[model samples]
Target chain A: MDEIPPVLLRILRFLLERRMLFQLLEPYEWWLRRKYPNPPLPQFSYQVTIHTIRNLYGRRGKIAWASLFFPSEFFHAARLIPFYPEIAIGLVAALRFVQTPLAAAEKAWFSQDLCSYHRGGIGMSLLRLFPRPDFLFATSSICHGTVGFFEVLREIWNVPLFLVDVPKQWTRDAEGYVAEQLTAIARHLEREWRVHFVWDKPFFFSNRTREILLEVEALRQRKDRMLLPPTKNLDYLPYYYEFLGEETSLRFAERLKEELSKPSKTLPHRLIWLHLKPFYSGELPALLEKLGLGVVYEEFTTPFPEELSPSSPLKSLARKILWASEILATSRGRIPGILEALKRYDAEGVIQFTQWGCRQSQGMVMLLREKLLEAGYPVLFLDGDHLDRRHSAPEQLRTRLEAFLEMLEGRGSS
Target chain B: MCTLGYFCRYVPQELLEACGFKAVFFKPDFSSPQCSSLPVPFCALCKTFISWALNHREFSGFVVPLACDASRRTYEILRALSVPAFSLDVPALAGETAVERLTENLDDLARELLAQSGRSFLEFTASLKQALEETLRQQEAFFREWGKRRRAPDRIPLLFSGSHFAHVLLPLLEEKGFLVFPDLPENRILLGEEPLSLTASPLEDLARFTLHRLPCPRLSGPARRTALKRLCGTLGLRGVVIVFSKFCDFQLYEIGLLGRSLGLPVLCLEHDTTPSFPQWETRLDAFREMILHG
Candidate 1:
């Protein structure tokens, strides 16, 4: 798939735009599901990935393009398909289809210094590869890139954009401010779509999903080994936020907990993976295996177990965004969570992978490194692009990982 | 009075002054720090701010505006390093809700500054009202003076827009026979002329005043684009020179929009806190020729 020519991709995109490509993919999806059933996390993830792509690319319904932290439940309530550009670009990068779109975006005046995920998505927008978004929604919660990226998308698509500005300090006034905006968007969406927002449905499903995720976390904590590989855990990033308000997500979470109930691989050193993993290549993952470094927990995949409220659903969403989301919480806010994860997994050290151009995450390295060191946990910093492999040197990454692993082992022996 | 420095215009100078602090815009004149935890991808302004914070001990406190991700993180890093600092969260959107949010934030900032200064509450309120009135007057006078400046017909008139504007480039642009009106946060004299009367709720009025300014690319709304277009037309500008720091997402993202909105030739140049003069000279010369000839 990675080797598929640009011309072929253009043709596929044309077919997909016209809703003919998924028909061709149906047979392939069926074969894939039969060949690799849902017990293994990778196979289950593969099934989910195909369904997500087909659903989103099929363009069967009204779609709203959103940032990572934009509540998926709003779209669910409004009967609109939520498309996350960052996740889509990550998948595209993993399959090696990112080069063309990336170049297209850069040519379109997107600086190479911006996040490649956003740049790649911009490229796709320029090329008209994705379905035309009817609306664009972004949160001021986590990454500042979303505002600029979504603003560009709004210009590209000439669609309405709703920006939910989440405040740094979580207070009643801030909650009300965000809740008012969320309610306004919801009302506007309802009027535009002629649909009543059934917030109850999303709340029910997401709450259940949250419950199961807690069970999974407890199971992982009880285990002495890594429940899943870091790369495999990263594959769940897209699905984590996008599918929260659906029954499919709930079922997947239950299955994930069930899967985690079983025993997993034990390695020399259990390390907590920070930020994002390299999605463009397998060299880092392979290196971790060779170094006998098992990732016990991933920062991006950590869940907030707090359930959404039915009475004040919008406020619940506001609270979740303001208080629960670790991405919004600066480095100091994340220290307690990191320390808890380290203790839970009995992780010997931390690997803080700084994604190229991700200032929000990368800025934390200094403070996080200091805090982690103070907590008696050694941190290894890896600098590379998660989506663009051209920025990564496998030799340099391997050397760093090997050295960190050896240090962990020496600490264990002592 | 305690002298506090700020890099962003959104930091309420009136409120700072009312609270008995001398507020001044601080521009970074240093290279990237030799040893820092901030990533290399951070905009030069941020790295330089970090470098400035580490080296300089002149300011009593630094008011870090939570305007961008880099700025927000820089605040945390400053705190971790135990620097005397205060964070004022600035909303990116412009509207009533955002104005109200900013007003509340500014009120909180006033409290912090007052606490730091140990000024009496009654005296603070009196000073705040007086300061607000004076700021509006100064801004109105500044607007009058700004609009009357004559553009030399011999030199191509251009609007300089971006997050970071190096004033050293002023002489360089002048020497190259180009008249550049810098539309950057650092040039606070060009802020919005919102002739809003000072009300009892001075913070709210100030919030409206600040937000109404020709917004930086970080802010989203029709007001900024409309303001920039109006400024270009009023000044009879031939083109826009977007001089942003390298790796700054806010300025980088605005390049396309400025070209589309301003309806003029757009020359985008990336620089650090300390820019390369020869390279800028070449770029500016070509841009000037393109405007003058073509």
Candidate 2:
């Protein structure tokens, strides 16, 4: 093969570095669409996934899987390979390969009335697109999706599965439950993997956790500041999901820090979009950018870090898991965390993207808006879908976002 | 004639009837046809109810109890659609305060219904109270009959999945030779009878029971293990029939976990509001076959 184009090479490097072709394909999504008309080579995709998995396992010499959001860092600390299915599902949804396997999973269970995420996840698993995780762990902070997803995987793969049950509201007991589950998971891993995870290394994990969270916080803060007037924060999406882990988090932090130190770019206003995939159709950020407003942060990308107390690994893990689980207790249960982000970033307004039929997020819209408003933040609740782009009221969302940004700017100037 | 839709083990039909509405309880079909079309996770009882509402236009309004997060959020969705809806806040299973709260909620519901329907609260309350009393009495009688069947040396005590079958269906199952010991109303009610005197929030108590008491298909390992232990110990159930709604992923996901946790035979029945009787009948026959042969 002749020298790959610089863009192609960058894509390949990204994929190889992430140890997954999907990660590489994620950024070059537009290219993939342009190159392959019909169903992009299934064999090729499968080969890439298999190759990535083998590489990951070979490198780590351990079986580990990272769940979405909080439990991910704990998995990383355990020295096991980490994989975020939400990231995979997000990529698939973005790439529009979600429909087929989602349909298939629905057919298997004779269910047509489930959430598309669940359908897509089941679809991905059925299609063998999702690498079989050796150990599966998820925090019940968001929805029944985590529980159901893991259970299905357990049944199919007979893999050791763990569910960290987070209550709808945060409480001491809930936190205790999380700590307990984390310990249980740790114990399970100790027995299964036969590798004793050092419980006394408190500073390493806690410090790492603090560092990652602060970095994430800084990124959100910087994005908010840059979103001042005509500037846009289009680049935040990839940075949020792709650069979350320890390996790339510091680099992302530095990049964001460097950007923030510079003189503020004049933008329309600073607004926070709630639970929105900023890169939907790769147009949201561009559209908002064009409208002269910058989306500073999203509720989904809150800088809630998962830190386990190595002093008592199991209990600490449970506590951390419980803390993580607190996310799913209510629709806007994640709002407090977001509010923290808003305060840290000095965000002016908030926009909650109420994706139609997303019960978990949709139900919390009113509560979230109320909370945001009470906190002196103006909130505009917009309804749309991530998977089915047709359901998106782009004009409506744009108008709402722009209007909110304008109000924020006016308030800021006054 | 206005048609009202509701769900649960014991739907208050008299209240609906007194308000000049035809009350219909539609169970969710968890099978393929209905599951794929729905946008939210089908595990939520409210989603199943609302999806039915969206697809069927005949319903004038919906009546739902603030039972769980799913139902509460579902009410929001309904409210947004401009659907005339009423939420009856049931007290969590705990204290005198809980009972007081429930009675107050019921009174409020009665007043709201009376206002909306131009009906007398006294008349509706009297009718509803009588109907509820009748249901409690009937349930007592049914429980005794079920107990008798369960005690029968020849009949195997069956643990019917609580999340799957409604209370109305339990009596029907008991009548059909299956000794149905559902994990909800009967077991939870028994467990929750003791009035909690502590200062713990009644809503928390209710949430706990609703979250932990009912056999949620999405329970973690410990919960699942405990449920399996309880199913084996308390019920002495020879087998379990997972009466999962068609699109409900929770129970289906738990099938393997439950199977592994308990070395028992499990037959999954994925049904919806349509009641696909023939398919269930076939599954039941097969289940019976497994019970007898295996």
Candidate 3:
């Protein structure tokens, strides 16, 4: 319910009129690619990067804003560009302009307690910075924040919303029901957008998406000895990226494996970070390197999931979605997956980054910490906003992480 | 008898009743805060529920239905507490398959109850059949007896849409000479006659009746405007009241859509289900006065 921030709106009007949003983004994206070069990796990320820019500044209309949890495949099938304001919020945070949106949302009566993603998204929407969607869509979660985020969009945009609600418990019945809903939503979006969706079903292993993902998965199995660097766009890369089910991400994964074929000699402490990490600090991974802690794998990012085969495309995707380690409501399915990741990565410690305003993770922070700590693993339940650095006190985080790392150092050395 | 505590209306009460467990909705005194609760900038209802569960060992077990993130997390918290929690995976989208999903959830709950109660499948079936018959009977009687008796104050009554029952809201409204219908879908379990197919198995019939028939704000395409009009007309309703837990995106959409579509005076109150600020009272009083004296 945030009113358009005058300052933001004025700036956006200028940017929109001049079509300089992505043009302005050029320097930043260019810098990031340069700062994190490992050879042959930049092309894939570069390919995926263009679409994010194009969706906002590319053209007018035929764009759909979606929740992060909504799979990118359906949108791809519909030939509709998926614009996630949540990611936009992240971009703002990465740009260190998050406070403006936060202030706008709070001033407009959005409670400070609401997810920062919602606040940032609403604030951006209020500024008319987000692209106008022909329609809005979301994959529903037990978290009302997801639905609430879109509801704000629907109210502001007055566009038709297509919502696909998922179940907390993963059963064949739930999977089938969700598949049916996804199919319905896909068809609805196609009809509404006046575009027919055709699922890319190649005769066999098209584009080697399966081959690359499986190889990535195999690399993850022996991460202890592998020189795996924390992925550049870690969280969004595996699932949210446009490069998924295509060669862009495949080449990126291939390059990553080639680079990480040999183990790091100096870095001793290996850690697995849970949930998505905020990109507010560009030097976060470098900071981790300084701490002698390298993130070997992310819970959501690793096990590079296989290609979305068109066989029972909806149901198969639904099955993958239902059993998805990260998407499930609570610690039920996620815990086992995380535990598996911890052992597979041979993690010395685990950092459960409890993003600000995300209730799904907040709901399970204590339990996740409890189980991990109880299992003789050093666990740090770090509370920070994913997109808003204002909520994350860097000094406090550093201190806690230092302590956790110290503890892990002792446990590892002894 | 086992006392099974629940928070969301989506969890089947009659299903639990069939399993021979005493099901009770957990309503905390919204005016007072439990000091031991986990203070987060999120749903106060889930925080309060989790806060309460953190200490008390009153219920033998808990059934946390999948409604929103808070409740789902509350389930995780209950499990962490080792409180024999059952998290029901209710669907947000209602359809034939949604009915099947809910049926599976209901059956899972039954299985959990059986494991705890040592009841046979046959016993559960009989209890379910009896419960189904009784639910149908209640639905019939509820509609038949609607507006037949004007035993109370002649103030305009409002149809409410909310997942959690804020018990204190009713008393506060009643003190202001207003009537609030706690149930939104005409019946508590959505056992409305419109969506029921009277399937072969009594359990399947009940699942269809509970989920498929319900027009929860979470679900898409419920013919909600028509349904709201019919229910309101039948009850001689004057306005709609949307009460949701704070930060519940699910209810906010319903609050906005239903408010616009109904073309009636709508009052939205977002409570944390804890005893905190009593700011909602003034709004309710104003809404009540508008429907009556205006």
Candidate 4:
């Protein structure tokens, strides 16, 4: 199982050739690494995590595909190594093998109107790159497409699918509702897989995981914030870690926080990123760095200051999940925290990535952009797909980024 | 005089009617203006929901169920705009707890509506029962008449699924000797009697009816499957034509499940908010040929 399918390896080679196009920045990267000797390589950690999970898929064990918003502690409890479509597609795209699988998904009647990550994930399964999952689970009200994604997964795998319906308002009733579902999921896993979810292992990891995120958040709050974006290729950071309940994901996060303890001096324009950055979709980040607009904060990677209450572990996890981010029920759900970040980071402008095929984040961008503009911050909805390189036509993105930079320039740096 | 709007069928229509608030179905139009940047700005229904909710001065309030991701965000956008709104957290999966939660949400909305409009729900239900019973009779008559119609023996039967009908294509399908059981949810539940007459308390009756009805893909797996099985069996369906809107996670995800569990031909049709919607011409024709020839 350790040996990869030759066809997949060949496809990877096809993608890797084009990915070499990014190597032109090596000398500059080398210089930065030389400047900051102990910085975490976000891309390196990203690859490590993806490879780790992908390897788990190859081994003989129960595999579950979950929505990004699902609690990882449950998967750990069930002894299922988890993966998700968006991140999986991203890993495939980053490896340069997204097109064939994406084409496969499209051919299998997957709509182009869905998120590209979904298309890529579905395509992966269609092309026999990603094997059918053993079980499927998802959380409602976060990503609009995840339910649809998992529904397709259920059909493919013919597995029992569980959906955790997260409420819009995080009330005590909502907590109880979700907790009941989690209990049901545990029972289902035990009956089907014939294994009990050992409580203490996940309990230990969940608490430690929260601690690391808090440390990262505190470091991010330092007076002199790093001018550079996450040095590590931080694709699916929270998701990858939380899904496996892996302490390594936390270790890397701590490394990132430790690396960014000091500011990268001053930059002309400070921009706050709205969601997950498309790390593999060409050289947008490096290009943005060159344009002198530092991403002072990112909504996805930065942890919120949450008080952990572990008296009821699952309930506490549910509380953390709600507090970590806003459920899809409201427009202004995540706005308050993001607005606080924008102010704290002294962001001159904001840019939300409208990842192709993903309606969840993109659906909220209009209100997000409008709110930022009203709050006196220039904002842009950067249209691109995370895994599909075609979304970031270098010239078009350059023009949009430049236009946004000009708008930011209009507001002279204090 | 407050005109309240709702999108999903799960939101109690009888209750809204009973509360004396004029209810509007937030229908999507092809040309509804979209926020060019927001992905699925209008969701499965389309940009019309957003444009209609944001721009229209007619509605005093909009109540949207948490059926899917897009509508949920729509609720949020409406709230942000300070438009009077209620986002009922429709449980994505069905169970006793989920049903209880939904009932509570419905109760909360009822309270809000009654408080705002100063009308008693009980009074409305009492006055509306005779009319509800009459509507059921009309529905029964329509179904009976439909069943009595003589049709060619070779006609292909399709169980229509998804959130809404591809209203424009029904005639075409009929022309092709296709009989459709329109179970894609708005008012199809009207055939069931539990909501209007099962209990003296209209709210309790509505909650029970909503929780226990033939499920849409929005509810729990077993319930949704059960609903599909019941419809396909009762209709004696030969195939399923699911007309799901673009960017609808709930409907989009259920395509494979619909195909799998029923062991029948399922032609999934996608609808965008485009003027020239991508009609599944080839697929439909192929589907027809398969069914007819078989």
Candidate 5:
């Protein structure tokens, strides 16, 4: 649980304004290492996570609302601390730490063909890495993994678990259902946590929502005259998942909004990321930006605020889920809304990120690229894993992005 | 000369019925353990269709669209068992090219079916079309009747569990005096059909829908419990019939959860295109008895 990298430690020390405390703790780290030679570490990463979370919240008196993306905003809005186990489990799977435990769980359950993420998450939960969440909320927005994963947690932990139901596609009725479920969950939380869950929390939820939406809208803005600094790709996930509900998240979003409002730095060719995690190498976005090519929008980032409607809270949630659903629905189908956004954002090319062994994504890549081509958008289908660099075709992706950017520039010049 | 029974989906049921063979469309019970053994990952309706077809000998054949991977696999498994299966490959799109390809596939299939069953394609096609047209008309009429039945005194109104099942099964169930309250299909279809303003990637959509739609027993705990509570509250439904296709893993995973949550008598059924009228009749009778007595 205490495997903090020195650099990250320094960063955290800086961020938390604990520089003097960090120096005081530095000598204790050496003394502790000598006192306990080879401290017994938890075999599973989730166990380590559980220990870390228990340490954090126990001291601070914060309750975690473990959730997926669909219920994330609502949970955040309700003022509950949100934890995304998928991001953690995904990182573990990519790192290949919990394979044996995952395999054992899969074999034990006789679910050999279940998604690796499900098996891994279950393995982590079984190992008690998640520490029993105060409340577990899952969205039926995507896949059976979270549903069963949370059920196992409920049975094991005997805690309150809620399923935020989202419809298969986005529609008004689905929005109504989602809104009702969110409201129900809100009531349940209020009863259990002894805290009022208000939707009209001025600067807390609604302000954050407005900020997220504005950030998204800014990301959608074109840099035809090179007015804005290109948004970093690596910052997207951490900004959303890690910083969500934190005051820093709102501040960072504000920083981005401010940066976008500034005059041109360098006009970069704009591109859109289709799927897969873009921040894996940490070099792609920087490289693209260096090469005067900016990633104007990412599929995951845009769906959050773009789906929200100020008039209807539940409808907004449902729309967000539906918007999220279309991104993963099928390969060949055209998301007119997303396409229109790409055009509006002045994205010259689209990068379809394909993770290996992700059957759902792999199955639809060819079809999706074909559709994008038909729509006259220069598309680059890049096959790689965000964590598993061994499977990454970085050189190929770079080549494709570069070539596509060149072609766009050529078209513009002609 | 040989009669056949087909369940849901619009394929060979009409043709088989028109060929002077008795065609009975039966929906299966989806809660039973016997129904869960089939190989599909989601949707118990397919399994019920298959289990009935395999158990009963009266029905001579089955026809289905290979619209999905599981159904296609089910068709193969059933075909190998000498079920005299006919599979029509329907494209994802409903364009002219898809229609042409489908017509050709169906024509070839219709010929082979005609020869094996001692029926001509011309006669079978005309009759089958008529039966299908009749079924469509009957389906429409049933909806109207269901609307009237909703207002009746003895109407056992049951809320269909989810959008996936409610889309196809709700109307059929409603026609039989069960009114589906809190419509799930109308909700799903309404959302699904609306144009997106900002959509996620296509893969993301698939993942989301698969997560939501695929009836995994393990994942649907919350949904099953919600459905059970709703059923208990709205209609005080005497019994719940969980319908799914054979080889659907998601729904099979859910049976225990649903059963435990509801405590109401649950009848689970699995089906493929194979006919199983006798077995289904027996099960339906048993279910009816349980509802009346238990």
Candidate 6:
């Protein structure tokens, strides 16, 4: 399990007031930049974190709590700082501070079987750990849990919740429906935040971010070696989802490409990662290294070349959400995409990490395994909860991963 | 007529009937061998339905709604397995466009089912018109009887709501001397208080009626609380009993707020594939005492 710094833990535990916490984050931000100055990519992430924190609690502007699927582009255009409570709770879990919040959530009748991230979020909300939101926004594109999770938060905070319903299929009518909702949200934000809403700013940043991420993706495909750690790509998930329309994200993407362009050692075995890895610990990364397997591509950071148009911003964003992997994962739509990524990256095996409570991804596992095997690739399925360390079984995971790696090596040799 | 099984209440049974199919609500059963095939974390109710669908291949088809993640994926699994299934996309947000979207989806489904039955458009329309009229009449009669039951004295009137299982509890509640007014999505089919009309566009009316019905937990807004509050007033409900399957996301998230919002003594029960009937009996016994004595 990942260990939290003793000092940081003590500080977090004792910091009862949001104002005091906000004040302490200033030094914490400085300490982070000072500690991680060599690798600018991690520094960029830290900077975004500090910026998000300041925007959320610093009272600099309006803040809208949203699901990750709610494209940050809209918030950027409306000048509202977007705060993803799920992602925030995920960070708390990674920091190993989720236990208290999770317990509090359960006390409030949040079941143990629901998504842990959501449970942690609710716990934090009940404990008043999060800032009050001007509003809550969510998209029904990823998982139904998001909608319910945000609805509960809306009740807790007594805020207006805006929902953008993205259909499973990408028809013109569906796109129009989503675009209309997006437009309504935009108008609502403009009136509430006292700012004129325009898509030009968000469109420019999204287009640039997309281009850079595509380059980063190309670098991954072209490089025969895995330069970074096994779970390094998973770190870019937040950037891809939450900062996709921000300058900081564009800088991070460019820096990531530059970092990946550097030459590194090639591993004996290469695998493609499906879904998310256990983010609460470094054990999986350690195991992958020990087993001499390098992850060439992670599905969450799989970059698409679609361009955002300023002319019809809502429609384009709506189309993007409709075609997102989470929505398409229900059908056989993601299978072709995964197969293409596998061939492009030239990975030898697939590892599907099934996060607990994620029925959308778990439901697709059997079909994914069948299709990948039929295409002459082996698959190893690993089950773990991303946000809860209680579910982590290091011994079992190590044994399964070791056996899968050995089998892959045997297949390659034979 | 062939049978078309469904689990969600949003699916228009009238349309299915018009297409020469009997709309059967698939109740949760625990004995299917295929239950083990689903992911372990899936809610018990969805697992039961998927297991049953996998084993019972004799049904003409099944209609799966886009109400929840489990149900949506159930549709995906059934389709992948080559089981005859139809996915009905229900919008999560409510609005004028949302109603129109459901109407369009209903139209698409009507067309597909009509083609499957090898019936002409005019014949399907005529049947749909007639089915709508009959449905409104039947639902009206159900409400009238429910009203009379509500006025009956010396009985504990309890509102039963949650994820669509534990219908087994309706009779059990009655056995326990509780007047149960079921407010579940499946029960809403016959309990819809909205008066639907048969017009040139009967599909539109059906869509409006379904959307306007007591809002399910999956639907966005506080409309669910509002509708339930009105129902509580209308029925003079004394308490609530929410029965949901294990790991049901919608119910788990909504039940707490619902209980608190209702401002009444509430008992929330969790059902698994193998529910502990004795434990429920003990809890119900205690709940009965509290309601009757207090």
Per TM-score, the best of the predicted structures is: 1
Docking class of 5: incorrect
Better of 3 and 6 by lDDT: 6
Best by DockQ: 1
| DockQ per model, Cα | 0.72, 0.15, 0.37, 0.49, 0.05, 0.69
lDDT of 1 at B27: 65
How does residue B170 of candidate 2 score in lDDT? 60
Question: Model 6: which residue pairs collide?
Answer: none
TM-score-sorted candidate list, best first: 1, 6, 4, 3, 2, 5
Instruction: Give the lDDT of residue A115 in candidate 5.
Output: 40
Q: List the residue pairs that clash in candidate 1.
A: none
Query: Number of clashing pairs, model 1?
Result: 0
Model 3 per-residue lDDT tens digits across residues B1-294: 778887766788877887878988777665545424353555676766666665557777888886777777777777777777887777665567667767777787788888888878898888888787777777767765653433455656777666554565677766767666655554432323452445558677777777644466665233555567666766667887766776565564455456546767877676666433357777877887788777
Worst 10 residues of 4 chain A by lDDT: A16-25
TM per model? 0.94, 0.58, 0.80, 0.84, 0.50, 0.93
Give the per-residue lDDT digits (tens) of candidate 4, residues A75-156: 7766777766666676667677777776666666665566777777777665555645777878764664666676676666
| Model 3: lDDT to the true structure | 0.66
Model 3 chain A weakest lDDT span, ten residues long: A201-210
Runs off by more than 4 Å, candidate 6:
A1-39, A325-328, B184-198
**Which of candidates 2 and 5 reaches a greater DockQ?**
2
> Model 2, which residues run further than 4 Å from truth?
A1-54, A57-60, A110-113, A167-174, A199-209, A212-245, A264-266, A278-280, A305-309, A312-316, A327-344, A373-377, A388-414, B1-294
Indicate whether candidate 1 or candidate 5 has the larger lDDT: 1
Any runs in candidate 1 off by more than 4 Å, and if so which? Answer: A1-10, A20-43, A223-225, A324-328, B30-37, B56-58, B184-194, B220-222
Sequence-dependent TM-score of model 2: 0.58
